[model samples]
Structure formats: C-alpha cells, structure tokens
Target: MMKRPFGIAVAQLGPIQPSDSRASAVARLVEMMREAASLGARMVVFPELALTTFFPRYWMSDEDAIERYFEKSMPSAQTQILFDTSKNLGIGFYLGYAELTTDGHRFNTSILVDQTGKIVGRYRKIHLPGHADHKVGKPFQHLEKKYFEVGNEGFHVWQTMDARIGMCLCNDRRWTETWRVLALQGADIVAVGYNTPSVNIHWPEPPHLRMHSHLISLQAAAYQNTTWIAAAGKAGLEDGCHLFAGSVIVSPAGEILAQTQSEDDEVIYCKADLALADTFRQHIFNYGAHRRPEHYRLITERTGVGDPLGKEPDPS
Candidate 1:
C-alpha cells in the first residue's frame, strides 16, 4: 500500500536566556509552531532543554538552585500555551525538557505529543555525557552527568498518526546501539534533539570535524536503519558557549531532505513518505534474512571491556 506524504519540520531554536521565564519560552515555541503550520507541517520537532539555557554549563552547589531548571509537570500553567497551540493548529510536536519525576528523579527527557495535544510517548536520554564532578579549571562546565540521573526507560517506539515514532536526546545520536534498538522495534521515523557545545573540553575536536561527525552519524543511522530521521538543535551561543546549528531532516535513503540555514531560530520543512522504509527493510537490510545475532552477543554482554570473551572469531 502506498502511503501519503506527511509534512514534517525541524525547528532550530536560538539560545534561551538564563533569566527567561517558561511563559516566554513557550511563546517563542508557539510562534515557531505557527510558522510550521503555515508551511503545512503536520509534525514538528524542537531542541533539547528548550525552556531554559543550557544550565548544566554552570556549576552550582545549591541543590535548590539546580532544581529550578527542571519541570515538575508537562503543560503546567507556564507551558499550557504550547499544548493548546499544537492542538489548535493540528500539529504534533516532539519537545525536549528536563523532567523531575514525583519520586525526585531528574532526567534529560523528551516527550512526543499527538495532534490532539495528548502525550503519547516519552523517552529519557540513555547516554549521559560529560563529567559528573565539577572541574574547577574548565572554562565552561558540562555537568549533565552531575545534574541528571541515568535514564531508566529503554529505547522504544510508538504507533503515532503519521508513523511509528521514537525519541532520543543529545548524546544518544552518537551511539549506534541507540539507533539499532529503535530500529529493532520497527520505528519508521526517529525524532532527536541536541544541544552540542562547539568546543570539546575532554579531547579538543576540530570545530569542523565536530559538525562533520554529527552529519555522518545521522546519515549512517538513517540508511543503516532505513528510517526517516529528524534532528533539531538549540543553536547559537548560550551564555559564553557556542552551539552550531545543523538541524536537518533525513530520508530513508540517507539523504538530507531539509536543513536549517542559520545559527538562530529557524524552521525547515520536508514532506516525508515513510513507506519508503519497506523497500530496504524487506530486501537488502531485512533483519530476519541477514542479521547474525548469534555472532553479535558481545555487543550486549561486554561491559567496558574490548574483548570480554578473550576469543577471536574463527576465519572460515
């Protein structure tokens, strides 16, 4: 059966000021949603930590001060406008935020909302990057490992209006296992959001190579998994840290369908035919036909060890 083309959007947001209130943030998001709706986008994706500045960049000893950045509930009085606007415009959106559960667990999380403004799926970031402890001499801090607890919800896909959707945040995009797990669950499209710093502190990476690595990862995952992927980013300089804008939408064939043109607030739209995934899934990359899971046990069993079994594969 041929599927209808659905218009999707990647909303690249500029930096959110440290002093900006959630109401102001949602207003900005609503304005972007209006633009997307005008462009006929049925689904839109926003960036990680969309409501606030990249707060993890600052080291704070006060727990109360750090907790201020997390949302206790989605669509609270401050964010209700985003939900109402999405429902009114009939446009679903994927939004990333800091989630504080009732049990006091904080996570780097993203939620998928349907066109009706209903929360349909949620994903917590699995790959928490950066140092957990405060480094006194670093120029800018990346305290994600210190601020948020490791996400417990494993990668999963959901049946949504346009396709089987999956969600991941930031560093999850760099891990091949992230895509493989989602693809294994039959995800037709994956939504990802990131706020990557232009500078790599641990091991300095060339600025150009950092962006190149990002694009290569997206292309490789899209083609290898045969799934449409939309990646959005919080662009521009936040405080003193710079974030490059490379927001894009990728086709099942690993081609970039649309991308942002600036390092600020921008919206890029593309019509995606999700059914194209079937061609690769049923033929060349069919898991049931070609996947040799028996020979790949090391991927799941090995933990922080290069050669856990101490045995090499026999050359037959």
Candidate 2:
C-alpha cells in the first residue's frame, strides 16, 4: 500500500494578552487557518493555552477569577467561529485550551477536530508542571499544579485520514514516556503545543540556552519514537514573561523540516510523507522486537514524583 503525504502547519502564536477577548483571539486564529490553507496545509496546530494568556503564570486568590479563565464548553459560541472556518476551508486542527467540565473538574486540554470540524479526539495534559501553591520568592508564579488537576486518562492515539495522530501538552513533551506510550499505540505523528517562559523560575538559565533546549527535546523525541512531530509554541513576551519561538516540524529522521522565523504569530507548513515513519519504525526503533516491557516494571512501580525543590532520589 502506498502512503500519501500529509501537509501540516505549525502555528506559533505570540501571546494572548489578558485584555484580549476570546473573540479577538479566535479571529487571529482564523486568519492563521486561512493562511495555512493557502499554503496547502491539510491540518494546522496551535500552541497550548492558545485562547488566552498563559494564566497559570499568575496566582488568583479569587475562585471566580480563576474559573473565568476556563471554558465551560469546548466550542463555546466564541470558539465556534474557528470550527466554522476550518469546515469552510476543509482543514483539520489541534487546539489547546483551559477546559472546565460540567463535573466541576478543570483541565489543561486539547482536542483533535477532523476536516469536517467535528471533534474526533480529546486529550488532557497528564504531566502538570509548576508548583501547586504560589511561591513568594519566585520572580513570577507558575501555578499550573494548582489550577489544573492531574489528567486521569492515559495517552491515546487517533486514526485519522492522513495518519495516526497523538496530542500532548507543554511539559508532557519533556517526558520520554509521553512519546513512547503513543508510539507503542502506533502513532505516526504527534502534535504537541507549549507555552514556555524563557526564564526558568525554579532555576534561571540563559534565554538562548532555553530555546536550544526546546529544539533538542523535539528532535530527540522524533528520532527516538520514529515519528513525525509538529510542535507549536506560544511565543513572544506575554505580560512580563518572554517566551521562546521555536515552533518546528520534525521528520521521522529527526530533521527539522519547517520552522517559524519570528517570535510572533506565524504559520509554517511541511508536506510529510507519512510512510517515512516505516523506515525507522520497522527497523532500529521496532518496539515489538526490541522492547522488553516486563523488565521495565520498575518504571511503572516508581512514579518518579519528586519534591518541588528538586530533591535527589533516595539511593536506598
């Protein structure tokens, strides 16, 4: 069987200011969708927390104020325009947002909508980064651990028209298990979105180094998993935080196929031959023949949870 090429667009957003209304943000996303369609892309991917500013950075004492940041309904009237636009253009998309389920649970979630604009799959971020409570000494706050619950559902992959796809959010990309789990389920392409501040509040490093770290992580994951990776970022400075713009599409061979040039709202596309994954997946990366899960029970037994202060693992 011959495999077809899938054109993917990675949309890097600058930032959604706290003052920007949801409608205005959707309008911007709509424009990007049109741009990607014009570029011959069949799917477009946006960064995590795309609809609003990265609210996790700020700690709100008022519960109502915190809830205000979450969307009660996924395709709320404000976001319906995005679905309508995608349907009109016949392009599918992966979008990340703050989800407030009717059951009263809040999650950092992302959804996969087919070309018809019908949502086919949904994923909640599992590895919630940052501290649960506000730290007084940190220059700024990273309270995602406080705002969103740890996702309960496990990693999942969806069978789409073009390829087998998977979704993961910001910090999840840093964990090797995130990609491995998806690969084990036969994912050919994984789309990840991130809203990362340039400064590591827990421990500060050079801004350029932080950006380099982002690319390295993406490339390594692509090669290790033998899958295509489309990673989008919320770039530019948001409020007082500076985010690195390195949104890129990586091939199964770990080559960067396309990337955004600016730290702003930009759309870049690449036509990936989905079959390319077979070159590696059936060879050096063949999990069925190479993986020995029974011997890896230690990984499952040890959750690897650590204290926020970076405590060394007990060498017991």
In candidate 2, residue 269 scores what lDDT? 98
Tens digit of lDDT per residue, candidate 1, span 124-214?
9989988778878888889898888889989999999858999999899999999999999988889999999999987778999999999
Name the runs in model 2 displaced over 4 angstroms: 305-316
- Top candidate on TM-score is 1
Report clash pairs, candidate 1: none
TM-score of each: 0.95, 0.94
Query: Model 1 scores what on Cα lDDT?
Result: 0.89
| Error in Å for residue 290 of model 2 | 1.8
In order, the Cα lDDT scores of the candidates are 0.89, 0.88
lDDT of 2 by residue, 106-213 (tens): 899999998989898999999998887778878788888888998888899999856899999999998999999998888889999999999988766888998888
